[model samples]
Target: MEIKDLSGMRKDYVSEDFSEKSLLADPYLQFDKWFAEASLVEEFEANAMVLSTSGSDNRPSSRVVLLKKYSKDGFVFFTNYLSRKGREIDENPWCSLLFFWPHRVRQVRVEGVAEKIVYEDSLEYFKSRPVISQASSSLSLQSSILEDKERFDKMIESLVSSGEDIKMPPHWGGYIVKPERFEFWQGGTGRSHDRFRYDLEEDHSWRISRLYP
Candidate 1:
């Protein structure tokens, strides 16, 4: 197989221009607006976001997670508490979430502190999941090394045959990121992108600023 070298890959962003004056005072509202637009696009997963977390060792890791919900409170996503990212969040609650919409040449970066949501909330979400998903989540040991596929299959088989209600694992739940900062980016032609950041103030008001890009 010949190795292909591709150094000339780029796309000129000609999407609608974003301006500071057009942004909402509240970052959450602004995010909602962008998300709603993204949702209307059939080709994109509007709720998918990259969650980045750091551990006590200061090593950072990121993974793609679905945004289950969002509001004035924060962005919510579910995961196994024993997962690598979960442990990292336990060690260091501060994290960042990045949402990239390449089709629209837009991105949203969020920095916040993550905390596990209440058990009742987790249970409600868990119950809404399909039975297969519930079974897999309950039986699977996330972020753990798997020696063989047989064991995993057997566990799922047993869970299915037992006909027991698949309950949420004690270590499985949702986490909400309480954002303190948000940066919205819109790609532009000539590599001159539009960037705006909203910082939460002590008085609970958001201060917006435009950045050179």
Candidate 2:
């Protein structure tokens, strides 16, 4: 066995300064702009984000989930309501979302309260998914121990070939995270990063402040 300690490794980021004058007054709009840029520059799924949640035990869990939708209201992602993350959200609604774009040398953090969207809306999105996807979601017991991988794959294949219209399970739907705060970070040279935080105020307005990095 070999142990490696290459602490000297580093990646320098040289980019335009993200100043206040260039920032959008609305944090949502600023996120939109950066998201668009990331979409163009990122070679893979730009909407992939880290969803972090803490359960009743106060143990934090993090997983990468695709961002299916977003707006001024909040961000949306779907999953089995009975999954681990889903159960955690039920126990504690407070969660945070993180988006990192390495190629763009940027990242965004969001702290929010998650709530299930309307069932009808979830059904609508479910119906819009491809038949195979719908079948997979319908058959999958996410976050559960997979006793038989081959059996599970066959089950999904069988369902997809049955020619029956798969319905979204009652235990499966979407959740929208209503953000209370947002932070945007841009990488800088010499290990100096640019960071800004947007805090929700009593008047439903945002208080944007720059933070030391």
Q: What is the C-alpha RMSD of each candidate to the true structure, in Å?
A: 1.5, 0.9
Mark the regions of model 1 whose C-alpha exceeds 4 Å error after superposition: 1-4
Over 4-43, each residue of candidate 1 has an lDDT whose tens digit, in order, gives: 8787887788868689668888899999999988788738
**Local error of candidate 2 at residue 204 (angstroms):** 0.5
TM-scores of all candidate predictions against the true structure: 0.95, 0.98
Candidate 1: lDDT over CA atoms? 0.92
Candidate with top TM-score is 2
**Candidate 1 lowest-lDDT run of ten:** 37-46
Worst 10 residues of 2 by lDDT: 8-17
